[model samples]
Target: MIHENPPLLTRIRPWVFVFDGPLAVGLALLVGISLVTMYSAASDYDGRMFDHVRNLSLAFVVMWAAACLPLPWMMRSAVPLYLLGVALLIAVALFGDIAKGARRWLDLGVTRIQPSELMKIAMPLMLAWWFQNREGVRRWYDFAIATVLLLVPVLLIARQPDLGTALLVSAAGLYVIFFAGLPWKVIAGGIVAGLAALPLLWSVMHDYQKHRVMMLLDPTSDPLGKGFHIIQSTIAVGSGGIWGKGWMEGTQAHLEFVPERTTDFVFAVFAEEFGLVGNGVLLLVYLLVIGRGLVIAASGASVFARLLAGAITLIFFTYAFVNMGMVTGVLPVVGVPLPLMSYGGTAMVTLGLGLGLLMSISRQRRLVQS
Candidate 1:
């Protein structure tokens, strides 16, 4: 009289169980939009677009793979994953490959790898696990310890002179700490201390780093040299106006005025082609993705899931915000990519992994509820 149970994967389906309905839909739309913009930015049916398609396909593969793993498996993997990340980072620092004056990559026989990218996920996962273990017994000392854990790799990255990724990794870790209920006074004090140490920090910065900040203050001071990117990108966004120039008809990108058109500066191309209206729509979609992430976080079955979900969501926000802000001349260029939109294999993979983790958390919540 008893019925046989369905296969594990089949039981979770309707496909939404793995993808999470709203998040999956939002991602589809975002990816579609990204492809459309990339085509225009690319200005031809060529290898660039094909490469993007390939990268996106790989990213989804990663997402699906991560989603299929059970929550306990992910939780158990956190420490080892984090330790591996730190070891890789140390390896990068000690005997890594140097390209373009930064020692951020390890040449692993077949291919070069950037270890800092691993910390983007590992830093948050490690912190979330730590806080989950200390759930009810959190103290100021614990928060300080969390900060140290967060800063170790951050300082290493900055030493690579990759201030952008360092900032991102730090943000990811800090989000977990904030979600764990770190005191406002501690946050405030850290801010004050950072501000107070600005002079010393400035002295220690590499010339290029110093130049970026200086250019942010007054790009016109060296318009032909350092200010070129901000100036051209801002012009592209402004030229887009209310309704855009109508897709590939964009003068900025077609004319090659917008630098890094397929990568970090891709937002300028999107803005130029689609205009203010397109930008608005894209922003709304990003907000929706973030909203879905927060919902997942709030509904998570465990403290670890909640913290990880929230951190990943805000990391998406930070990526988009920093990229847009830099392109618009509101912030200094720090080489951040517009999530799902920018053309880079590594960034795409990182984003996919984070979303996969979010999907895993969402799936866990649903399982708990059922």
Candidate 2:
């Protein structure tokens, strides 16, 4: 039974083949950027860079496991996962730990979990599954039903006062519905209706949420208070100018002027260090990843896979756009993190799962064609 050693690629094909090539490369680039940016941003905080590495490693493993799962199995588990997520969200609402004035985490004896993060993936999954089952015979009311499915968890998350997660979940589900053939008029009407309901929405919003919007309108109104974040972050971004401050030389980050340097405002650190050119490169990588996701969705093996892949792809876009917009003071701060760039375990894990699902869909398409 003695034999010569197998070629290196042959030995690793099973592992390597599990991921889509372009998507893997795009993620690797982002991960490398995250490490480099975090090193500078977390220089004053001992062990923060190490913790980021650990979080990234966990995210990579989660993504790999998700990529290995069969598409049929993913579809089969969709309903149960969605139900479990909703149940956990309900439980969190009933008896969750309040942290930073928001009840978003459920203490599960051993560790705490954010059920809303689960909805970021589960919402799209459930909706995709629903639309897939109704393919070729979908009615307008089917969209209505899908909207209800989307809203239940969204309202729950919003009630947790995590507007950021709620918005992300809503975007994820809406993308699925749109790709599943939502009408243009309906979308137009929804937008108009949403605009009409602004006053009501404002009245219901928490005071802090209202403050964020006001700060967006004028950060100088409370420069030393709620508006400080937008003020400081915009300085970091604009200070970068054309060629950047050259890596670790970023004054805003080094001087601790940029708030949340390691998390939500990491983009400000990145922008200050790398400047507009670096932001362009980062955005290109994101676009490549997003383009690969769209390709996967277009070539999906089933309607379920298509809708899920498309929704997940757009969710990545939303994360990046919102984070950067807030950092640049163009949009209201909503606590959204830069995808694959921010330093947080729960969000990283959720993003990894979404990426993994994309890989699975991509790999499945290849398998069928082959």
Candidate 3:
């Protein structure tokens, strides 16, 4: 029988296989190219699509570098990173330029940056670290304190009127709480309490948020206004039928019938061009990314590693699923992007951090014998 290497770095450095890293990279590359193509189609030959591709390429490189770094050091820096994220959020809230009736981004003169994007990683990282410290926190009150930790950022995010992002951050933190073996009874109790306090939450919701729910209930009531986005998206997706309209041929995108075609509604564009098969492929890529993540979680090297990796993994799943589901009329529309496939800076960085955690776990596994 042959034996694996016993050298420290030799045993550890090979963890990068990562369920066929080449295939994952190839698929990611294919998807990015597709997004760039869709961007051009939507732009009607604008130069901005080129810039989007450049940024996306840069994001991939950053993710690669992060994935190669060590995990313990990253976790050690968790508090500082979380504080930095909070500071950025505060900066955005206090002195940020306003756009589209929401103060969601900081104007860097050349480009706009959103801080809430960092919370997607920071929240999970902080919670995992918290659990690591309170290793024996097996009580309901401990879970409550954890919930408070999650709520603080959710409140800050909601104050930005970025409800979609607020919901996402909430989901990220909630994943940690749930994974901490939080009692099911407490969860059910919280659900009941939430339902009971629906009126209070509704009171705090921005007018536009309430209208989203209303429009979802009856798009026909306001076809030209709040309902327009969902209506256009459904038309674009449904028009694809079995075979799709073909790449760069979606009239919805070409004719500008689809809103946010290169961003929020990119899935609709992909669906319209590729039809059911394209959608199926997208789902497969997503499943592969998430499946590899879960495998890491199941065999993760430590509790912190497991929690951080698992939350990030499911958060990725949440991102793809929410974006696709919302675009397809199966879920309420929230502005969640489609992870690596979506064009954005903040989201890409978060995905990079997440990929780093997964790679960290994998690295630990390989180094186990060393």
C-alpha displacement of 137 in model 3, angstroms?
Answer: 5.3
TM-scores for every predicted model? 0.96, 0.96, 0.89
Better of 1 and 3 by TM-score: 1
Choose the strongest candidate by lDDT: 2
Candidate 1 vs candidate 2: the lDDT winner is 2
> How much lDDT does each candidate structure score?
0.92, 0.94, 0.79
Q: What are the per-residue Cα lDDT tens digits for candidate 3 across 1-370? A: 9987688877755544442363366447556645755564546657656756776677666666666666787779878888888888888889887888888888878987788888888899899988887786577787878888788778878888898899889999999888889888888988999999999998988889998888888777899999898999999999999889887788887898888877788888888888898788777777777888888787777778888888988998898889988887777788888776666666766676677667767667667745
Model 3 residue 235 lDDT score = 96
* Alpha-carbon runs more than 4 Å astray in model 1: 1-16, 44-46
Candidate 1, lDDT over the whole model: 0.92
Assess the local accuracy of residue 20 in candidate 2 as a C-alpha lDDT between 0 and 100.
Answer: 95
As a whole number from 0 to 100, the lDDT of residue 79 in candidate 3 is: 84
How accurate locally is residue 177 in candidate 2, as Cα lDDT from 0 to 100? 93
The predicted structure with the larger lDDT, 1 or 3, is 1
Model 1: which ten-residue window has the lowest total lDDT?
8-17
lDDT (tens digit, per residue) of candidate 2 on 1-370: 9999999999988676799989999999999999999999999999999999999999999999999889889889899999999999999999999998999999999999999999999899999999989989789999999999999999999999999999999999999999999899999999999999999999999999999999999999999999999999999999998889999999999998888999999999999988999989999999999999999999899999999999999999999999999999999999999998899999999999999999999988988998
